[model samples]
Target: MRRVVQYSTGNVGQHSLRAIIGRPDLELVGVHAADPAKVGRDAAELCGLTEPTGIVATDDVDALIALAPDCVVYTALGETRPMEALSEMSALLAAGINVVGTSMVWLVTPRQADDWLRVPLEQACAAGNSSLYVNGIDPGFSGDTAVHAALSLVTRAASITVQEIFDYGNYDDYEYTGTAMGFGNTADAERPLTFRPGVIATIFGGLVRNLAAHLDVELDDIRERYEPWYSDQHIECRMTTIEPGQLAAVKFSVEGVRGGDTVITVEHVNRLTSKAAPDWEFPPDGQSGVHKVVVEGEPRIEMSTSLSHPALDVTEAGCLSTAARAVNAIDWVCRSPAGLVALEDIPPTELIRGVMW
Candidate 1:
């Protein structure tokens, strides 16, 4: 059994902790809590489990490293603190702990990451002979594996588009939905950090570039487009309140263009409420969220994936999938060669085992 450490207790991290505890092939050795109050608590209590796991959460990185875990499931928020996230992951890797995480979306395709970002992690892995893999629902399975699976059914493909359509009404992360995304900000206010030029590309562009590279297609340039929808009335979401005429939804895409034609695209249709964007795409059958892949070619293929959990809301279930993507890959990541491992590097069927269902 591989010893594991869970590196946060946020939305995704909690799920990661729970999955690690549920799995019979993994041992929960330690947990790193970002919040001071969470420190010293039992891992099970932090993740909503009724029973204790005997393992306690800590804020000390060195203490976690001292455990000598085979891998660490990192789900820390990295969108705003990219550098700090990088440094923390690097420290883990350099200390000989393999890592699988949903943070650092750019690392989903490490080949496309800038040298400054990629080199340090590579060096750390070399120093410790460890490996790091990063993925999640959107930049993780939807854009990579799921889209590739759809492509296999097509004889020829002209353009590929991956979409994440979700209603964030139940999403409870205020810092993300409010400050980072500007979901409740007035339409006239400055664009949120996420809507700024190149931010979308930095986050989701790696998927486009990775797809293009897989097809052996050279991209002329990567382009971005942002469109916002304003609320017609006051709308209160679990995360933030949207006033009349305030931004409530956003539709954005990062496209990979080749010779003036877009080849690969990653798009998101995120709304604070269903009423925010009537014209924009919505999940089929009134579902709150769905990840879709559309390929236009000889035989057009469209595949949509929706997730649900009996005890959790749609948004929470989505977070569980994100956590599972990395947690399930623990064994493969541990056995793989040292360095940044990409989705393509992993055997498609190697990680499937011990499913509860």
Candidate 2:
């Protein structure tokens, strides 16, 4: 069995903690939480699990690293503090602990990552003989592994389009809905950094570039576009309230250009309400969320995936999947050579069977 340490107790971290405790092949060793309230709490209680696991959450990164478990599931938010996240990841890797999580979206394609971000990680991994992998739902399974699987059945492909259409109403996080996403803000309000130019490129550009690499094609450039929809009337939900004409939905797209034609595209249709943007296509499943990848080519294929666990709604299921992807990869990453790896570098089926096999 692999010994595992969980980092953070946020949306994904909580799920990781639960998964680690439930897996017979994994032994929960430690858990780290940045929030003061979560520190010293039982791991099971933090994740809503049925029984207590003796493991208490702590804030000391040094203590967590000292565990030197087989892997550290780092699910802390990196969007607000990328450098700090990198530093922590480096420290864990240098401590000889395999690292896997959703913290760094750009590391989904490690080779394509910038030197400033990649070198320290590589050096650390080499020094400690450890490995690091970053992944999540959109930039992870639906982006590379699943898409590549779909492409394998095709002989030729001209373009690939992947999308995440999700309704934010089901997610009960006010900070995410109102502040981070700028949901209730007016159109004149300064745009959220998430919508700024190159931000999409900074976050998901690797998926486009990685797809090109997978297909043995070259990209001319990667481009980003953003569009927002305003609510027509005041609306209140479980999370936050939105005034009429306030930002209700946002669509972000990243495209990879090849020979003047768009060859790869990734889009996110995030809305506070299912009906917020009638023009933008909602999930065909009619569920709270749906992820689709379309290939415009000889076979012209389309793959639609959804999440609905017995006890999880679409939003919670999404977080669980993100945690599952990273947690399940722990064994594979720990057994592999010391370095940064990508989804394409590992057996995708491990995501299905987990560490059971």
Candidate 3:
């Protein structure tokens, strides 16, 4: 059985943790949490699992690696501190421990950092004779899902768009604040940078850019716009002063030109709360759900599924399943080539059958 270790104890971490523990072919070796609150809780109990292993989650990486886990599942948010996270990833790979992570939205895509980041990771994997893969529901499966959805239609496609809407009633974090996010934009002439390192534009920016490249569409310009609201709004999750109107919305768009010709267009809307103008509820539009994909074509097709699991939103179980696919494919990637890899590079049935098989 493959032994797995996990890092972080947040949304993605929770879902992933449950999945790892429940797997019959995999063993939950350890859990690592940056938060001191959960530093010493049973691995299972910490993640709401009924089966409690004596293993207490810890923040000691050196100790966790000493256990010789086959892989490390990392779901920590590396947006603000990418360099630090990469350092940790480097150490794991160099120690001959495989890694499956979703901290970066575009690591495996061609949009990944080409300088110090990619070079060191490739070298570490080679030195340790191990493999590493980065993926998640948004840029990972959503991009692939949208592309596949578009292929179902015939004729030259004009453009494509993907969007995600979340009910932010329960999201009382600092990340969504208008001042922090720069939500609303007054003019289309100005595409202001929020300076947020991994904003939605920064996160899915590569997806649209890479898609245009793959289609041989010369990219001219990429742009992003934000919309924020505030007022009395009723949210399903909670009652707050900052209601749906007082929320942030992000609109991402990409225009591709072939030989200076307009080839395709991509756009998406991400509303954190309701935009209750004259009449509306909480999160005026977007509600908590799995991402969505829409492709415009001759035989138009669409694929939509809430990526979150039942009874759990971004729990340890989901994180475990996503990370496992990345880990299970490690051996396959090791014996193969180097550089970036995509989910399309791996078979779907094989990925799903990891623990089951």
Candidate 4:
């Protein structure tokens, strides 16, 4: 069994802990937690497991690294702290610890990342002779491999569009709901991160660029579109409520265009409730959350994914999928060459489903 350490206890990180423990080939060595309440707690309890594991959570980064575990599942948040994540990953790599995590989703297609950040990470990998792989639901299975499989049946390629449509009301994170996404704010307020100029390019544009590269197409320009929908009436959720005329829904799209035609695109239609945006695109079953990919080509293929766990709700299950994506890739990353590993670099068979069935 490969010795492993989990780097955080967030929603995804906790799920990753459970995954690592259940894996037949992995041994849980230690866990890291930044929250004062979580530190010193048993890893199993922190992850909501019924029993305790000997492993306890700690805030000491150096001490955890000193354990010399085979890999670190660094599922800590990175969207708001890209440089900090890069620095941490670089140091871990330089220490010869292989890393596979969901923090930097764009690293699934590393070529699309900024050169400045990429250079130091590459150098660190070389120095320590350790590898790093990053992935999540959107930039991982739901976007890249799914789209790649759908496009294989087509003889002619026209366009590709990948979308994530979900309700964000149950997501109780104050920073993400109020500040980053403007979920409970008024319609006139400044748009959220998805709508902000260049933000999409910085975060998810990697999907578009990577798809274009896979298709061997040169994009003329990468364009973005944002539309925020307001609720006419009050909407209630488990955590917070959306008052009348508040920002209830948002639609964001990034397209890879070539000579006026869209070849690759990534889109999201997110709302606080299903009632908030009745007319927005949804799965045939009208599910509130789904990741969809459409190939507007010869076969005109379309595929959608909806994830659920027995103990978790739809949104929480989505978080688990993100964690599973990273956890499942841990062994492969640890065995790979020391450098940035892209989605294409790994064999598709390596991503087989686990005990989740």
CA deviation > 4 Å runs, candidate 1: none
Q: Please list the C-alpha lDDT of all candidates, in the order they appear.
A: 0.91, 0.86, 0.61, 0.84
1-357 in candidate 2: lDDT tens per residue? 899999998988889888899988899999999999999999999999868899999999999888879999999988678899989999999999999998777888888898989999999999999999988887788988778767887888888999999988868776653566778889999987777777778878888888888778988899998988999987777667888889888898999998899989999998987758889989884778888999888888989898888977788899988888898888888899999988878876665665554
lDDT (tens digit, per residue) of candidate 3 on 48-114: 8877788889999999989988878878877667788889988888888777777765575634455
Q: Quote each prediction's TM-score.
A: 0.98, 0.96, 0.79, 0.96
Candidate 3, poorest ten consecutive residues by summed lDDT: 276-285
Tell me the deviation in Å of residue 132 in model 1: 0.3
Better of 1 and 2 by TM-score: 1
Candidate number with the higher lDDT (2 or 3): 2
Taking all chains together, the TM-score of candidate 4 against the true structure is 0.96
Every candidate's CA RMSD: 1.1, 1.6, 4.7, 1.7
1-357 in candidate 1: lDDT tens per residue? 999999999999999999999898999999999899999999999999989999999999999999999999999998789899999999999999999999988898999998979999999999999999998897789999999999999999999999999998888997865677788777678998888988888888888988998999999999999998888898877978888888889899999999999988899999987888999889999999999999999799999999998889999999999998899899999999999999999988875755553
Which candidate has the highest lDDT of all? 1
TM-score-wise, the better of 3 and 4 is 4
Indicate which candidate wins on TM-score. 1
lDDT of 2 at 48: 91
